[model samples]
Target: MAAADPPSPTGMGFFGMLSFRRSATAVASFDPAQEDELLALHALHAHVADRLEALSSHAQPQGPVLSLPFLSKLLDAVLSSSDAFRAVLALAPVAAAVSRPPADRLAADLLDRSIKMLDVLNAASLTLASLRGAHRAALTAASCLLAPALHRAHFARARRAIARIFPDDAKAGATAPSPSSRTMRALSVSVSKNWSAGRHMNAMAAHLAPPPQVPAAAAAGAGCGLGLALYTMSSVLVFAMWALVAAVPCQDRASAAISPPVAPPKQAQWAVPMSSLQDRIAEEWRRREKKGSSSGSAATAGLLAEMQAVERAARDLNSLLEEIAEEEEDEQAAVAIVSEERTREVTEQAEELAAACRALEDGLAPLERQVRAVFHRVVACRAEVVRCMEHVPRTASSNAAASASGVPPPQHHSF
Candidate 1:
């Protein structure tokens, strides 16, 4: 009997998305040429670009900004790209093709990037927790919106919990900063004012830092295709992380922009799609960035469709609270009329908040799972890449690589 095919290297969650084996081969043949490997890399990158474009285009109704749907696809793209990247890097040919120095450098770049991404995941988890806290508080407040007896009581109870999300610049250097006013805490990021996501993002950009120019295949000598592929992979990896930071709320979130993605060469097929998507997302970021909290638009609160909805709904509820309170003061009534219109207004606003809350509730758990999945994917790929370089000697041929490693040449599973 024939032996079973080896376990897929791209992880079981994603392998079903695309065949990772050499199709139509009667046996486990795994020979592919240098040009075929390069084409495999190109196809991988193009698939990523196509998915991102589709993600943005289809979600145009959600202010065409990054939404929950867009983020889901974006994270999927990262997973697919990382799979292709690590799969290619693990091949005996790739190990043979890239020299030790350049390979080490590439691995170092990716490893550093993976470390930064972990930090991003941590911040994202915290930010999501803050949002969940605010979400629950909003629901609680909604329950009390029309309850005259609970007006002051509910707001008093929720005010402190919800206030922890807004960022305050004055508190940036404070070892133990005092909370801001109720109005100031309406919507935004963490109460951890000293933590500047922008600063962290900038540091990451400075660390992985793009090269002045991507080397020509000829200039890269024997390992041209693999070397160039690694560089391009690193660039896309960095851009993906930067995009994640921008799409989610964090401390000083708007400052999370990284230098625009390094454009792929015009000759590359994915160049047009990739560049167009970058321009579109940047435009969205610019629109929200300019509106900002100072612009008095809740639109800048976040790029998530549900996040924006939740904040707008929260504002609507807050406005109703203000109006009712003012009405009570003017009429000088110890008990305000529980009139149909007033109750209706309160109910409508609370329902709006509930709708937004439901949207967030439905999407957030999956979103968290995806982020955690991405974190582990990057970790696995980084370890594989480092191991790839460590096992590959400086001057080994593909045969030597296969022989030394006691494995067959790996197949190129280009989608």
Candidate 2:
């Protein structure tokens, strides 16, 4: 029978299948393009890590109201950096599989670091959401207080003007409009509706027209007094018009009710010539009316233009706030999803690494046993050789001693 062939070295176990030696050779082969790709990946990882660290340091929440603009910018940066790092991480398993042990170790380390960074990003996104909610609450509270405060301020200014225009007795006796008065309601409504309408000077002129049926002396005295009051109340009229325009539901009806056409009294009946005083009053009224119709119209038009401009600005502000809020929400959702996915991916990678380790250990166990068996056989063979040599040793030395002592030598026996 043919001698039995020795076992064929058991295919070198898992080490042979993994071919780590081949990986080492591949690592030694430096294709510039591959080197460049690896370098790029490393650089990208460093950049992303730096950005994450910076964001983690800076994104601490601090106030009752967050600056939406700032938060929006921060979220954008975090998302971009996290996305870049995630892309790099996605290649980690492939790198680990194909590269040498050192590269595999680096890939595993990178995955761990990336997972930590993602956790940081998730925390920041949640903080931003909380801040947004707080900001919205603050805005709502301010909105609740705004209109009423403005109404109160407008009425207070109107009251002061009315006091300065009228006599102390009349002012003391006058009952000011209540906050809930229809006139105030009308004023607010009209301001909202007719603020852009063109000036109606005739209506204003009629409204300011003087009362009829006074004695010449009384008229003169009144004219002089009226002139003084008008001087004091010139500035008051501008604000008063705002109030009147707001208070009067209908301009035609208010004007008709306030001023009725009165025929001038017979000039002959007057003992004193009050023409100068009358002229002064009429001149003042005419000047004031003309100013209201002409220059005041221009001013009103400019004011309306300004108001419209402010409205546009407010609209833009509102839209920007809404955009920031929406972006925060979207970023938060993205962060949550990414974080969960990354966790699962990391778990899978860890399991794979563990499996690979277990496989390596299993493969190493049989190889260790084979090496021990070979070592034991070599030791036994050495012991047998030593025993045979001991039995045959000292023959030459013994023969030399016997010749010196005249002793007989042993003869060889033939089989």
Cα misplacement distance, residue 296 of candidate 2 (Å): 55
Where in model 1 is the C-alpha error above 4 Å?
1-32, 61-64, 101-104, 146-196, 206-220, 296-301, 394-415
lDDT of 1 by residue, 110-164 (tens): 6776776666776776666666766676667566663654445554343332333
lDDT of 2 by residue, 296-315 (tens): 33211111111222223323
Model 2 gets an lDDT of 0.30
Candidate of highest TM-score: 1
lDDT for residue 252 in candidate 1, whole number 0-100: 75
Please name the candidate that would achieve the greatest lDDT relative to the true structure. Answer: 1
The whole-model lDDT of each prediction reads 0.60, 0.30
